[model samples]
Target chain A: MTGALIAGIAAGLLAAVLHFAFVQSYILLGEQYETGELVHFQTPADHATEDHAAADQHDHGSHEHGDEPSVLQRNALTVGFTVLLYVAYGMLLTAGFAIASQFGRKITATEGALWGLAGFVAFQMAPGMGLAPELPGSAAADLTARQIWWWSTVVATGGGLALLAYGRSILTVVAGIVLLALPHVIGAPLLDAYYGYAPTEVGAIFSSRVLGVGLAVWVVLGWLAGRQWDRGAAA
Target chain B: MTTTTQTKTQSLLAPILGMAVIGLTVLLAVGHAQSATLHDAAHDMRHATGFPCH
Candidate 1:
Protein backbone atom coordinates (compact mmCIF):
# COMPACT_ATOMS: atom_id res chain seq x y z
CA MET A 1 0.00 0.00 0.00
CA THR A 2 2.78 2.38 0.91
CA GLY A 3 4.55 1.42 -2.26
CA ALA A 4 1.45 2.00 -4.32
CA LEU A 5 0.94 5.42 -2.76
CA ILE A 6 4.54 6.35 -3.39
CA ALA A 7 4.31 5.12 -6.94
CA GLY A 8 1.18 7.19 -7.44
CA ILE A 9 2.87 10.37 -6.26
CA ALA A 10 5.88 9.78 -8.47
CA ALA A 11 3.79 8.96 -11.52
CA GLY A 12 1.56 11.97 -10.92
CA LEU A 13 4.57 14.30 -10.77
CA LEU A 14 6.05 12.88 -13.96
CA ALA A 15 2.74 13.03 -15.77
CA ALA A 16 2.37 16.65 -14.65
CA VAL A 17 5.78 17.42 -16.06
CA LEU A 18 4.78 15.86 -19.38
CA HIS A 19 1.51 17.79 -19.34
CA PHE A 20 3.31 21.06 -18.68
CA ALA A 21 5.82 20.40 -21.44
CA PHE A 22 3.41 19.25 -24.15
CA VAL A 23 -0.17 20.10 -23.28
CA GLN A 24 -0.18 23.45 -21.49
CA SER A 25 0.52 25.58 -24.56
CA TYR A 26 -2.45 24.24 -26.49
CA ILE A 27 -4.69 24.91 -23.54
CA LEU A 28 -3.36 28.43 -23.18
CA LEU A 29 -3.98 28.99 -26.88
CA GLY A 30 -7.51 27.72 -26.58
CA GLU A 31 -8.10 30.01 -23.62
CA GLN A 32 -6.90 32.97 -25.65
CA TYR A 33 -9.38 32.09 -28.35
CA GLU A 34 -12.06 31.48 -25.81
CA THR A 35 -11.50 34.85 -24.19
CA GLY A 36 -11.46 36.67 -27.54
CA GLU A 37 -7.77 37.47 -27.77
CA LEU A 38 -7.71 35.66 -31.08
CA VAL A 39 -10.50 35.21 -33.60
CA HIS A 40 -11.01 32.46 -36.11
CA PHE A 41 -13.53 31.81 -38.88
CA GLN A 42 -14.64 35.41 -38.27
CA THR A 43 -13.20 38.71 -39.37
CA PRO A 44 -10.97 40.36 -36.79
CA ALA A 45 -12.44 43.73 -37.64
CA ASP A 46 -15.77 42.67 -36.24
CA HIS A 47 -14.60 42.20 -32.68
CA ALA A 48 -11.09 43.65 -32.62
CA THR A 49 -11.72 46.69 -30.52
CA GLU A 50 -14.12 45.00 -28.16
CA ASP A 51 -11.63 42.17 -27.77
CA HIS A 52 -8.80 44.56 -27.05
CA ALA A 53 -10.86 46.33 -24.46
CA ALA A 54 -11.76 43.06 -22.85
CA ALA A 55 -8.13 42.00 -23.06
CA ASP A 56 -7.06 45.21 -21.44
CA GLN A 57 -9.47 44.71 -18.56
CA HIS A 58 -8.30 41.11 -18.20
CA ASP A 59 -4.68 42.16 -18.28
CA HIS A 60 -5.28 44.69 -15.58
CA GLY A 61 -7.06 42.21 -13.38
CA SER A 62 -4.61 39.32 -13.89
CA HIS A 63 -1.35 41.18 -14.35
CA GLU A 64 -1.77 44.49 -12.64
CA HIS A 65 1.84 45.60 -12.71
CA GLY A 66 2.05 45.59 -16.52
CA ASP A 67 4.42 42.76 -15.87
CA GLU A 68 3.08 39.34 -16.76
CA PRO A 69 3.67 36.52 -14.35
CA SER A 70 7.23 35.33 -14.56
CA VAL A 71 7.80 32.19 -16.53
CA LEU A 72 8.70 30.53 -13.26
CA GLN A 73 5.40 31.53 -11.63
CA ARG A 74 3.37 30.38 -14.60
CA ASN A 75 5.17 27.07 -14.87
CA ALA A 76 4.93 26.49 -11.14
CA LEU A 77 1.19 27.05 -11.09
CA THR A 78 0.63 24.92 -14.16
CA VAL A 79 2.80 22.13 -12.79
CA GLY A 80 1.32 22.48 -9.31
CA PHE A 81 -2.24 22.21 -10.56
CA THR A 82 -1.40 19.34 -12.87
CA VAL A 83 0.39 17.49 -10.12
CA LEU A 84 -2.48 18.02 -7.69
CA LEU A 85 -4.99 16.62 -10.13
CA TYR A 86 -2.76 13.83 -11.38
CA VAL A 87 -1.88 12.73 -7.88
CA ALA A 88 -5.53 12.03 -7.21
CA TYR A 89 -5.75 10.27 -10.55
CA GLY A 90 -2.62 8.30 -9.78
CA MET A 91 -3.86 7.22 -6.39
CA LEU A 92 -7.04 5.89 -7.88
CA LEU A 93 -5.14 4.14 -10.62
CA THR A 94 -2.80 2.60 -8.13
CA ALA A 95 -5.64 1.42 -5.98
CA GLY A 96 -7.34 -0.15 -8.95
CA PHE A 97 -4.06 -1.83 -9.80
CA ALA A 98 -3.85 -3.20 -6.31
CA ILE A 99 -7.29 -4.69 -6.62
CA ALA A 100 -6.31 -6.28 -9.93
CA SER A 101 -3.14 -7.68 -8.47
CA GLN A 102 -5.21 -9.60 -5.99
CA PHE A 103 -6.39 -11.75 -8.86
CA GLY A 104 -2.91 -13.21 -9.34
CA ARG A 105 -1.92 -11.00 -12.22
CA LYS A 106 1.67 -9.87 -12.20
CA ILE A 107 1.97 -6.12 -12.37
CA THR A 108 4.23 -5.05 -15.23
CA ALA A 109 4.97 -1.82 -17.03
CA THR A 110 3.34 -3.08 -20.23
CA GLU A 111 0.23 -4.04 -18.34
CA GLY A 112 0.34 -0.67 -16.62
CA ALA A 113 0.44 1.06 -20.02
CA LEU A 114 -2.55 -0.95 -21.11
CA TRP A 115 -4.42 -0.01 -17.94
CA GLY A 116 -3.54 3.62 -18.55
CA LEU A 117 -4.94 3.43 -22.04
CA ALA A 118 -8.11 1.94 -20.63
CA GLY A 119 -8.29 4.83 -18.19
CA PHE A 120 -7.85 7.35 -20.97
CA VAL A 121 -10.59 5.62 -22.90
CA ALA A 122 -12.93 5.56 -19.94
CA PHE A 123 -12.37 8.98 -18.46
CA GLN A 124 -11.69 11.14 -21.49
CA MET A 125 -12.33 9.48 -24.84
CA ALA A 126 -15.63 7.86 -23.98
CA PRO A 127 -17.20 10.96 -22.43
CA GLY A 128 -15.62 13.05 -25.15
CA MET A 129 -17.46 11.10 -27.80
CA GLY A 130 -20.63 12.69 -26.52
CA LEU A 131 -19.56 15.97 -24.94
CA ALA A 132 -16.36 16.72 -26.90
CA PRO A 133 -14.06 19.37 -25.48
CA GLU A 134 -15.45 22.86 -25.05
CA LEU A 135 -13.62 26.13 -25.17
CA PRO A 136 -14.24 28.83 -22.52
CA GLY A 137 -17.18 30.55 -24.12
CA SER A 138 -18.78 27.61 -25.91
CA ALA A 139 -22.45 26.86 -25.40
CA ALA A 140 -23.23 23.73 -23.39
CA ALA A 141 -26.02 21.77 -21.86
CA ASP A 142 -27.08 22.14 -18.25
CA LEU A 143 -24.10 21.65 -15.95
CA THR A 144 -25.89 19.20 -13.69
CA ALA A 145 -27.03 17.08 -16.58
CA ARG A 146 -23.63 17.05 -18.23
CA GLN A 147 -21.86 16.17 -15.00
CA ILE A 148 -24.27 13.35 -14.29
CA TRP A 149 -23.82 11.92 -17.76
CA TRP A 150 -20.06 12.27 -17.67
CA TRP A 151 -19.72 10.51 -14.34
CA SER A 152 -22.03 7.70 -15.32
CA THR A 153 -20.17 7.16 -18.54
CA VAL A 154 -16.84 7.00 -16.78
CA VAL A 155 -18.13 4.51 -14.25
CA ALA A 156 -19.82 2.33 -16.82
CA THR A 157 -16.88 2.33 -19.17
CA GLY A 158 -14.35 1.66 -16.47
CA GLY A 159 -16.39 -1.14 -14.97
CA GLY A 160 -17.11 -2.60 -18.36
CA LEU A 161 -13.47 -2.57 -19.37
CA ALA A 162 -12.47 -4.24 -16.16
CA LEU A 163 -14.93 -7.03 -16.78
CA LEU A 164 -13.97 -7.40 -20.41
CA ALA A 165 -10.30 -7.63 -19.58
CA TYR A 166 -10.56 -10.01 -16.66
CA GLY A 167 -13.82 -11.88 -16.79
CA ARG A 168 -13.57 -15.56 -17.54
CA SER A 169 -17.12 -16.23 -18.60
CA ILE A 170 -19.05 -15.23 -21.69
CA LEU A 171 -21.80 -13.83 -19.52
CA THR A 172 -19.38 -11.43 -17.88
CA VAL A 173 -18.05 -10.26 -21.21
CA VAL A 174 -21.55 -9.64 -22.51
CA ALA A 175 -22.45 -7.73 -19.41
CA GLY A 176 -19.33 -5.64 -19.83
CA ILE A 177 -20.20 -4.80 -23.40
CA VAL A 178 -23.67 -3.77 -22.36
CA LEU A 179 -22.36 -1.52 -19.68
CA LEU A 180 -20.03 0.07 -22.17
CA ALA A 181 -22.84 0.75 -24.65
CA LEU A 182 -25.51 1.74 -22.21
CA PRO A 183 -24.31 5.31 -21.86
CA HIS A 184 -24.18 6.01 -25.56
CA VAL A 185 -27.53 4.37 -25.98
CA ILE A 186 -28.96 6.77 -23.42
CA GLY A 187 -26.84 9.48 -25.00
CA ALA A 188 -25.38 12.57 -23.40
CA PRO A 189 -27.65 15.57 -23.09
CA LEU A 190 -27.26 17.96 -25.99
CA LEU A 191 -28.44 21.45 -26.86
CA ASP A 192 -31.02 21.73 -29.61
CA ALA A 193 -28.37 23.17 -31.87
CA TYR A 194 -24.65 23.60 -31.83
CA TYR A 195 -23.66 27.02 -30.61
CA GLY A 196 -20.25 28.35 -29.75
CA TYR A 197 -18.13 31.46 -29.87
CA ALA A 198 -14.98 29.65 -30.96
CA PRO A 199 -14.70 28.09 -34.41
CA THR A 200 -15.71 24.48 -34.84
CA GLU A 201 -12.26 23.60 -36.10
CA VAL A 202 -10.62 25.07 -33.05
CA GLY A 203 -12.83 23.02 -30.77
CA ALA A 204 -12.08 19.91 -32.82
CA ILE A 205 -8.35 20.46 -32.63
CA PHE A 206 -8.56 21.19 -28.93
CA SER A 207 -10.51 18.03 -28.29
CA SER A 208 -8.15 15.81 -30.25
CA ARG A 209 -5.00 17.33 -28.80
CA VAL A 210 -6.31 17.04 -25.25
CA LEU A 211 -7.10 13.38 -25.80
CA GLY A 212 -3.66 12.82 -27.28
CA VAL A 213 -2.01 14.36 -24.26
CA GLY A 214 -4.25 12.38 -21.89
CA LEU A 215 -3.23 9.15 -23.62
CA ALA A 216 0.46 9.88 -23.20
CA VAL A 217 0.10 10.88 -19.57
CA TRP A 218 -1.95 7.82 -18.69
CA VAL A 219 0.53 5.49 -20.36
CA VAL A 220 3.41 6.97 -18.45
CA LEU A 221 1.46 6.95 -15.20
CA GLY A 222 0.48 3.31 -15.57
CA TRP A 223 3.99 2.19 -16.48
CA LEU A 224 5.64 4.01 -13.64
CA ALA A 225 3.07 3.06 -11.03
CA GLY A 226 3.22 -0.60 -11.99
CA ARG A 227 7.00 -0.69 -11.92
CA GLN A 228 7.06 0.97 -8.52
CA TRP A 229 4.41 -1.30 -7.08
CA ASP A 230 6.18 -4.39 -8.33
CA ARG A 231 9.48 -3.22 -6.97
CA GLY A 232 7.92 -2.51 -3.62
CA ALA A 233 6.33 -5.92 -3.53
CA ALA A 234 9.65 -7.51 -4.35
CA ALA A 235 11.40 -5.54 -1.65
CA MET B 1 -9.37 -18.54 10.06
CA THR B 2 -12.26 -16.12 10.42
CA THR B 3 -9.88 -13.43 11.56
CA THR B 4 -7.60 -14.03 8.58
CA THR B 5 -10.53 -13.88 6.21
CA GLN B 6 -11.76 -10.69 7.81
CA THR B 7 -8.31 -9.17 7.50
CA LYS B 8 -8.14 -10.08 3.86
CA THR B 9 -11.52 -8.54 3.24
CA GLN B 10 -10.53 -5.38 5.00
CA SER B 11 -7.34 -5.16 3.01
CA LEU B 12 -9.28 -5.41 -0.21
CA LEU B 13 -11.93 -3.00 0.95
CA ALA B 14 -9.55 -0.36 2.17
CA PRO B 15 -8.09 0.74 -1.14
CA ILE B 16 -11.40 0.77 -2.94
CA LEU B 17 -12.87 2.87 -0.17
CA GLY B 18 -9.94 5.20 -0.26
CA MET B 19 -10.22 5.60 -4.00
CA ALA B 20 -13.92 6.24 -3.78
CA VAL B 21 -13.53 8.87 -1.11
CA ILE B 22 -10.76 10.71 -2.92
CA GLY B 23 -12.52 10.46 -6.27
CA LEU B 24 -15.75 11.83 -4.91
CA THR B 25 -13.98 14.64 -3.12
CA VAL B 26 -12.32 15.64 -6.36
CA LEU B 27 -15.56 15.40 -8.27
CA LEU B 28 -17.32 17.62 -5.78
CA ALA B 29 -14.45 20.05 -5.58
CA VAL B 30 -14.19 20.34 -9.32
CA GLY B 31 -17.89 20.35 -9.97
CA HIS B 32 -19.31 22.46 -7.19
CA ALA B 33 -16.67 24.12 -5.07
CA GLN B 34 -17.42 27.71 -4.12
CA SER B 35 -13.87 28.92 -4.25
CA ALA B 36 -13.02 30.53 -7.55
CA THR B 37 -9.44 29.31 -7.38
CA LEU B 38 -10.48 25.69 -7.04
CA HIS B 39 -13.17 26.12 -9.61
CA ASP B 40 -10.89 27.82 -12.08
CA ALA B 41 -8.19 25.21 -11.69
CA ALA B 42 -10.67 22.46 -12.23
CA HIS B 43 -12.32 24.41 -15.01
CA ASP B 44 -9.06 24.71 -16.84
CA MET B 45 -8.58 20.99 -16.41
CA ARG B 46 -12.02 20.27 -17.75
CA HIS B 47 -11.13 22.26 -20.85
CA ALA B 48 -7.68 20.75 -21.00
CA THR B 49 -9.18 17.27 -21.10
CA GLY B 50 -11.86 18.39 -23.51
CA PHE B 51 -14.65 17.96 -21.01
CA PRO B 52 -17.38 20.41 -21.84
CA CYS B 53 -17.56 23.65 -19.89
CA HIS B 54 -19.54 26.63 -21.03
Candidate 2:
Protein backbone atom coordinates (compact mmCIF):
# COMPACT_ATOMS: atom_id res chain seq x y z
CA MET A 1 0.00 0.00 0.00
CA THR A 2 2.79 2.39 0.93
CA GLY A 3 4.65 1.61 -2.24
CA ALA A 4 1.52 2.21 -4.29
CA LEU A 5 0.89 5.51 -2.57
CA ILE A 6 4.45 6.61 -3.18
CA ALA A 7 4.28 5.58 -6.83
CA GLY A 8 0.99 7.42 -7.28
CA ILE A 9 2.40 10.67 -5.89
CA ALA A 10 5.54 10.36 -7.98
CA ALA A 11 3.61 9.71 -11.17
CA GLY A 12 1.18 12.57 -10.53
CA LEU A 13 4.01 14.99 -9.93
CA LEU A 14 5.78 13.86 -13.07
CA ALA A 15 2.73 14.39 -15.27
CA ALA A 16 1.83 17.73 -13.65
CA VAL A 17 5.34 19.16 -14.15
CA LEU A 18 5.39 18.08 -17.78
CA HIS A 19 1.98 19.67 -18.40
CA PHE A 20 2.95 22.89 -16.62
CA ALA A 21 6.11 23.18 -18.69
CA PHE A 22 4.15 22.54 -21.84
CA VAL A 23 1.66 25.32 -20.99
CA GLN A 24 4.45 27.71 -19.99
CA SER A 25 6.22 27.12 -23.28
CA TYR A 26 2.98 27.68 -25.16
CA ILE A 27 2.45 31.04 -23.43
CA LEU A 28 6.04 32.10 -24.08
CA LEU A 29 5.64 31.33 -27.76
CA GLY A 30 2.95 34.01 -27.96
CA GLU A 31 4.88 36.40 -25.76
CA GLN A 32 7.97 36.21 -28.00
CA TYR A 33 5.98 37.46 -31.03
CA GLU A 34 5.28 40.84 -29.43
CA THR A 35 7.01 43.87 -30.99
CA GLY A 36 6.18 46.37 -28.25
CA GLU A 37 6.15 46.01 -24.46
CA LEU A 38 6.23 42.61 -22.78
CA VAL A 39 3.19 41.51 -20.80
CA HIS A 40 4.83 40.29 -17.64
CA PHE A 41 1.61 39.61 -15.81
CA GLN A 42 -2.03 40.58 -15.42
CA THR A 43 -5.02 39.45 -13.35
CA PRO A 44 -7.60 37.20 -15.05
CA ALA A 45 -10.39 39.79 -14.87
CA ASP A 46 -8.34 42.58 -16.49
CA HIS A 47 -6.83 40.14 -18.94
CA ALA A 48 -10.11 39.47 -20.78
CA THR A 49 -10.91 42.84 -22.33
CA GLU A 50 -8.37 45.41 -21.17
CA ASP A 51 -5.22 43.55 -22.15
CA HIS A 52 -6.64 42.56 -25.52
CA ALA A 53 -7.57 46.16 -26.28
CA ALA A 54 -4.16 47.33 -25.19
CA ALA A 55 -2.47 44.80 -27.49
CA ASP A 56 -4.58 45.96 -30.43
CA GLN A 57 -3.84 49.66 -29.71
CA HIS A 58 -0.14 49.11 -30.28
CA ASP A 59 0.04 48.34 -33.96
CA HIS A 60 2.78 45.80 -33.22
CA GLY A 61 1.94 42.92 -35.53
CA SER A 62 3.46 39.41 -35.64
CA HIS A 63 6.74 40.31 -37.42
CA GLU A 64 7.66 42.92 -34.79
CA HIS A 65 7.38 40.23 -32.13
CA GLY A 66 10.32 38.14 -33.37
CA ASP A 67 9.97 34.39 -33.45
CA GLU A 68 12.14 33.54 -30.49
CA PRO A 69 12.70 29.99 -29.25
CA SER A 70 11.26 29.85 -25.75
CA VAL A 71 13.50 29.22 -22.79
CA LEU A 72 12.29 27.18 -19.81
CA GLN A 73 13.36 29.46 -16.98
CA ARG A 74 15.22 27.29 -14.51
CA ASN A 75 13.93 29.10 -11.46
CA ALA A 76 13.30 27.24 -8.23
CA LEU A 77 9.86 28.82 -7.71
CA THR A 78 8.48 27.95 -11.13
CA VAL A 79 9.93 24.46 -11.39
CA GLY A 80 9.17 23.56 -7.80
CA PHE A 81 5.49 24.57 -7.94
CA THR A 82 4.90 23.02 -11.37
CA VAL A 83 6.50 19.74 -10.35
CA LEU A 84 4.51 19.66 -7.14
CA LEU A 85 1.23 19.77 -9.07
CA TYR A 86 2.46 17.01 -11.38
CA VAL A 87 3.37 14.86 -8.40
CA ALA A 88 -0.05 15.36 -6.87
CA TYR A 89 -1.83 14.28 -10.05
CA GLY A 90 0.49 11.30 -10.34
CA MET A 91 -0.27 10.28 -6.78
CA LEU A 92 -3.99 10.31 -7.51
CA LEU A 93 -3.62 8.09 -10.57
CA THR A 94 -1.14 5.68 -9.01
CA ALA A 95 -3.16 5.45 -5.82
CA GLY A 96 -6.32 4.66 -7.74
CA PHE A 97 -4.59 1.82 -9.55
CA ALA A 98 -3.03 0.63 -6.32
CA ILE A 99 -6.39 0.32 -4.68
CA ALA A 100 -7.75 -1.48 -7.71
CA SER A 101 -4.84 -3.93 -7.53
CA GLN A 102 -5.75 -4.98 -4.01
CA PHE A 103 -8.79 -6.78 -5.39
CA GLY A 104 -6.35 -9.35 -6.82
CA ARG A 105 -8.72 -9.67 -9.77
CA LYS A 106 -6.20 -7.35 -11.41
CA ILE A 107 -6.29 -5.55 -14.72
CA THR A 108 -4.28 -6.33 -17.84
CA ALA A 109 -2.26 -3.92 -19.93
CA THR A 110 -5.30 -3.43 -22.14
CA GLU A 111 -7.62 -2.92 -19.18
CA GLY A 112 -5.26 -0.50 -17.53
CA ALA A 113 -5.02 1.43 -20.77
CA LEU A 114 -8.79 1.60 -20.93
CA TRP A 115 -8.86 2.86 -17.37
CA GLY A 116 -6.32 5.56 -18.20
CA LEU A 117 -8.33 6.58 -21.22
CA ALA A 118 -11.36 6.78 -18.97
CA GLY A 119 -9.48 9.12 -16.65
CA PHE A 120 -8.50 11.54 -19.43
CA VAL A 121 -11.98 11.55 -20.87
CA ALA A 122 -13.52 12.39 -17.53
CA PHE A 123 -10.97 14.75 -16.07
CA GLN A 124 -9.19 17.14 -18.43
CA MET A 125 -11.00 16.95 -21.74
CA ALA A 126 -14.51 16.84 -20.37
CA PRO A 127 -14.04 19.48 -17.73
CA GLY A 128 -12.26 21.82 -20.11
CA MET A 129 -15.04 21.57 -22.64
CA GLY A 130 -17.67 22.55 -20.05
CA LEU A 131 -17.53 22.62 -16.26
CA ALA A 132 -13.90 23.73 -16.23
CA PRO A 133 -13.21 27.44 -16.64
CA GLU A 134 -12.06 28.61 -20.05
CA LEU A 135 -9.48 31.27 -20.85
CA PRO A 136 -11.58 34.32 -19.94
CA GLY A 137 -10.15 36.35 -22.80
CA SER A 138 -10.80 33.83 -25.54
CA ALA A 139 -13.61 34.12 -28.11
CA ALA A 140 -14.96 30.78 -26.96
CA ALA A 141 -15.70 32.26 -23.56
CA ASP A 142 -18.22 34.66 -25.04
CA LEU A 143 -19.78 32.35 -27.57
CA THR A 144 -22.92 30.84 -26.05
CA ALA A 145 -22.68 28.13 -28.69
CA ARG A 146 -19.27 27.08 -27.51
CA GLN A 147 -20.18 27.30 -23.83
CA ILE A 148 -23.02 24.84 -24.23
CA TRP A 149 -20.79 22.34 -25.99
CA TRP A 150 -18.20 22.67 -23.27
CA TRP A 151 -20.60 21.93 -20.40
CA SER A 152 -21.97 18.86 -22.11
CA THR A 153 -18.45 17.51 -22.22
CA VAL A 154 -18.12 18.05 -18.49
CA VAL A 155 -21.23 16.00 -17.78
CA ALA A 156 -20.03 13.33 -20.13
CA THR A 157 -16.64 13.09 -18.47
CA GLY A 158 -18.12 12.66 -15.02
CA GLY A 159 -20.54 9.98 -16.19
CA GLY A 160 -17.79 8.26 -18.10
CA LEU A 161 -15.51 8.08 -15.04
CA ALA A 162 -18.27 6.57 -12.95
CA LEU A 163 -18.86 3.98 -15.65
CA LEU A 164 -15.18 3.12 -15.88
CA ALA A 165 -14.87 2.62 -12.14
CA TYR A 166 -17.87 0.36 -11.79
CA GLY A 167 -18.54 -1.00 -15.28
CA ARG A 168 -18.11 -4.68 -14.46
CA SER A 169 -21.13 -5.05 -12.24
CA ILE A 170 -24.77 -4.77 -13.34
CA LEU A 171 -25.51 -2.51 -10.40
CA THR A 172 -22.61 -0.31 -11.33
CA VAL A 173 -23.83 -0.08 -14.91
CA VAL A 174 -27.24 1.03 -13.65
CA ALA A 175 -25.58 3.59 -11.43
CA GLY A 176 -23.71 5.01 -14.41
CA ILE A 177 -26.96 5.51 -16.29
CA VAL A 178 -28.44 7.26 -13.30
CA LEU A 179 -25.41 9.47 -13.02
CA LEU A 180 -25.61 10.47 -16.66
CA ALA A 181 -29.30 11.24 -16.28
CA LEU A 182 -28.69 13.57 -13.36
CA PRO A 183 -27.36 16.41 -15.53
CA HIS A 184 -30.62 16.46 -17.44
CA VAL A 185 -32.81 16.40 -14.34
CA ILE A 186 -30.69 18.54 -12.06
CA GLY A 187 -29.75 20.95 -14.84
CA ALA A 188 -26.06 21.88 -15.49
CA PRO A 189 -24.31 23.53 -12.49
CA LEU A 190 -23.03 20.13 -11.31
CA LEU A 191 -20.86 21.76 -8.73
CA ASP A 192 -21.25 25.48 -7.94
CA ALA A 193 -20.96 28.81 -9.80
CA TYR A 194 -17.33 28.09 -10.56
CA TYR A 195 -18.44 24.86 -12.16
CA GLY A 196 -21.62 26.03 -13.85
CA TYR A 197 -22.72 23.94 -16.85
CA ALA A 198 -24.31 25.09 -20.08
CA PRO A 199 -27.04 22.93 -21.46
CA THR A 200 -26.42 22.76 -25.17
CA GLU A 201 -26.44 19.86 -27.59
CA VAL A 202 -23.44 21.23 -29.46
CA GLY A 203 -21.46 21.73 -26.26
CA ALA A 204 -22.28 18.19 -25.23
CA ILE A 205 -21.04 16.97 -28.57
CA PHE A 206 -17.83 18.93 -28.26
CA SER A 207 -17.25 17.64 -24.75
CA SER A 208 -17.75 14.04 -25.81
CA ARG A 209 -15.26 14.28 -28.67
CA VAL A 210 -12.59 16.10 -26.72
CA LEU A 211 -12.92 13.73 -23.77
CA GLY A 212 -12.84 10.69 -26.03
CA VAL A 213 -9.52 11.72 -27.51
CA GLY A 214 -8.12 12.42 -24.05
CA LEU A 215 -9.14 8.92 -23.01
CA ALA A 216 -7.24 7.45 -25.93
CA VAL A 217 -4.05 9.12 -24.71
CA TRP A 218 -4.65 7.78 -21.21
CA VAL A 219 -5.09 4.30 -22.68
CA VAL A 220 -1.64 4.51 -24.20
CA LEU A 221 -0.11 5.75 -20.95
CA GLY A 222 -1.91 3.08 -18.94
CA TRP A 223 -0.68 0.41 -21.36
CA LEU A 224 2.91 1.55 -20.84
CA ALA A 225 2.46 1.63 -17.07
CA GLY A 226 0.82 -1.80 -17.03
CA ARG A 227 3.60 -3.32 -19.08
CA GLN A 228 6.13 -1.92 -16.65
CA TRP A 229 4.17 -3.36 -13.76
CA ASP A 230 4.07 -6.74 -15.49
CA ARG A 231 7.82 -6.66 -15.97
CA GLY A 232 8.28 -5.83 -12.30
CA ALA A 233 6.02 -8.71 -11.30
CA ALA A 234 7.86 -11.09 -13.57
CA ALA A 235 11.17 -10.07 -12.07
CA MET B 1 -2.99 -39.25 -17.13
CA THR B 2 -4.43 -37.48 -20.23
CA THR B 3 -7.50 -36.42 -18.21
CA THR B 4 -5.28 -34.79 -15.55
CA THR B 5 -3.37 -32.86 -18.22
CA GLN B 6 -6.64 -31.72 -19.81
CA THR B 7 -7.93 -30.52 -16.45
CA LYS B 8 -4.81 -28.40 -15.89
CA THR B 9 -5.25 -26.81 -19.30
CA GLN B 10 -8.90 -26.08 -18.53
CA SER B 11 -7.95 -24.36 -15.28
CA LEU B 12 -5.62 -21.95 -17.10
CA LEU B 13 -8.15 -21.45 -19.88
CA ALA B 14 -10.92 -20.46 -17.47
CA PRO B 15 -9.24 -17.37 -16.05
CA ILE B 16 -7.99 -16.25 -19.46
CA LEU B 17 -11.41 -16.58 -20.97
CA GLY B 18 -13.01 -14.69 -18.11
CA MET B 19 -10.52 -11.87 -18.36
CA ALA B 20 -10.93 -11.65 -22.12
CA VAL B 21 -14.71 -11.53 -21.86
CA ILE B 22 -14.64 -8.79 -19.24
CA GLY B 23 -12.04 -6.87 -21.22
CA LEU B 24 -14.19 -7.01 -24.36
CA THR B 25 -17.19 -5.61 -22.52
CA VAL B 26 -15.12 -2.75 -21.14
CA LEU B 27 -13.73 -1.93 -24.56
CA LEU B 28 -17.22 -1.74 -25.99
CA ALA B 29 -18.45 0.52 -23.22
CA VAL B 30 -15.49 2.83 -23.63
CA GLY B 31 -16.02 2.86 -27.36
CA HIS B 32 -19.54 4.14 -26.83
CA ALA B 33 -18.27 6.94 -24.66
CA GLN B 34 -15.71 7.89 -27.28
CA SER B 35 -18.22 7.93 -30.10
CA ALA B 36 -20.38 10.64 -28.51
CA THR B 37 -20.68 14.08 -30.18
CA LEU B 38 -17.69 16.48 -30.12
CA HIS B 39 -16.82 20.02 -31.24
CA ASP B 40 -14.44 20.79 -34.11
CA ALA B 41 -12.10 22.95 -32.04
CA ALA B 42 -12.13 20.50 -29.16
CA HIS B 43 -11.60 17.65 -31.60
CA ASP B 44 -8.59 19.45 -33.04
CA MET B 45 -7.23 20.01 -29.52
CA ARG B 46 -7.54 16.28 -28.88
CA HIS B 47 -5.44 15.63 -31.96
CA ALA B 48 -2.89 18.12 -30.69
CA THR B 49 -2.59 15.83 -27.68
CA GLY B 50 -1.67 13.04 -30.17
CA PHE B 51 -4.85 11.09 -29.61
CA PRO B 52 -6.72 9.36 -32.42
CA CYS B 53 -10.25 10.73 -31.79
CA HIS B 54 -12.16 8.56 -34.23
- In terms of DockQ, which candidate is strongest? 1
- lDDT tens digits by residue: candidate 2, A211-235: 4434544555556555555454456
Off by over 4 Å in 1: A1-22, A39-75, B1-6, B27-34
Q: Ten-residue segment with the worst summed lDDT in candidate 2 chain A?
A: A133-142
Where's the lowest-lDDT run of ten residues in candidate 1 chain A?
A: A57-66
Tell me the whole-model lDDT of each prediction, alpha carbons only: 0.70, 0.41
Q: What is the i-RMS of every prediction?
A: 2.7, 13.2
Location of the lowest summed lDDT over 10 successive residues in candidate 1 chain B: B26-35
lDDT for model 2: 0.41
Provide the lDDT at A148 for model 1: 83
